[model samples]
Target: MGTAAVSIEHLGYRYPRQSNIFTDLNLQIEAGERFGIFGPNGAGKTTLMHCMTGLLSFQQGKLSLFGNDIATNKKETNKLFGFVPQDFSFYQELSPVQNLEFFGAWCGLNKQAIKQRTTELLEILGLADVRNKQVQKFSGGMKRRVNLAIGVIHDPRILFLDEPTVGVDIQTRNAIINYLKELNKSGTTLIYTSHQLSEAEELCNKIALIEAGEIIAHNTLDNLLSEHKEDGLEGLYLNLTGKAYRDGNV
Candidate 1:
């Protein structure tokens, strides 16, 4: 059998002077799967993604990508995955082409490669017309597209997305979703987290529902719905995690 795209065993994490964030967490995601991690505010969904991507340190457990231990092979493992955070990661003053050029270089691409990729992404993501405009002047949907383009600039084998389509028009949302689907079809494993349950249902083939830092449910979307007797992800989520308004930093 081939190695899993991502694997975590006995993971534990907590901030200083706080209660445990999560403990004994374990998960495995195979390649070429659109995997969604869904949870309410402050449920540690983002934190878990951070741990997987090495953005935050964890106190215990092991993380691996494609069978290589992350701790021991941080550089090697890092090259295989890309993270598109919720916030804008590019410099606001830079044009999209300039931003892509800088990030592409950071990702170790040659100048020619960077130019080609920048052109391709701009065209495919509908940013070609505004390629030279500063990102700060773009709309939210345009900014989100820029965020996505940067994340995949290196053409990573595994892509991690946190609230990728949080605030955007339906047209932009559809565009991003369709592009993500294309990435998956081309063999990029996707690990995503979001509060948009309906969108999650549409994008993910596999689902893991987290609550209070614990994975309460994990299965294929169809199997989860059928087994829990819930018609949709929202129903399953509310049924399991409760409908009370969760108060925490999103």
Candidate 2:
């Protein structure tokens, strides 16, 4: 197996008003691996991502990014990963190229490299025409593509994506997935959360099912199916987490 790009051991977290979100969660993702996180709406997937990124503190467990403990060196550790959040938040008035340029600058990329990468990313994401258009006027799919480009501009070794295709169209979704696959093939490790089981099945080599802040299952896709004797991820998810209503105020 390749070296681990990210590692989490005995991770536990809780919110003041909320119950424990995660407990004794242990996971390791190796370089060039594509892993998916699946769970119900209230399964604490986002919370786990926050904890991994060191945006939120956890009571126990250790999280390491690129072999450095996140708790002790959060700033340096965070630099080893790229994050694409569920929501696309950017300067609405800025064009796609301009936004990428600004973020690349913040990431400390040289002007020539930023310009070249921006061009390549825009073309790859099929946003070439809209590269100069203001983000405020773009569609949801377009905005999501731009969000992805920004996340990967610095080319971090590992990537974290939270429901990346949530609001995108089928065409854009496929495009994004293909690009991510290419990145993985080129040595980038990916960890993402998704509600789309089919997408997860096609893109993820392994999966971790989280429910009520705990990992109910973790293994390769085929192993999970064989162990549970389930037809697919959706069936496995229902069997593990159940179909009970999880209605709660967000």
Top candidate, metric TM-score = 1
Name the candidate that leads on lDDT: 1
TM-score of each: 0.98, 0.95
Model 2 C-alpha lDDT per residue in residues 1-250, reported as the tens digit of each score: 6558888999988888877778788988777789998888878888888988788999999999878999999778877888999888578899999999999988778999999999999999989998899999999999999999999998988899988899788999999999999999988889999988999988999989887777889999999999999988889889998989875446
Residue 190 displacement (Å), model 2: 0.9
List the candidate 2 regions with Cα displacement exceeding 4 Å.
248-250
What lDDT does each candidate get?
0.93, 0.89
Error of 2 at 89 (Å): 2.3
Cα lDDT of model 1 by residue, 31-103, tens digit: 8999999988899998899999988889999999999888788889889998899999999899999999999
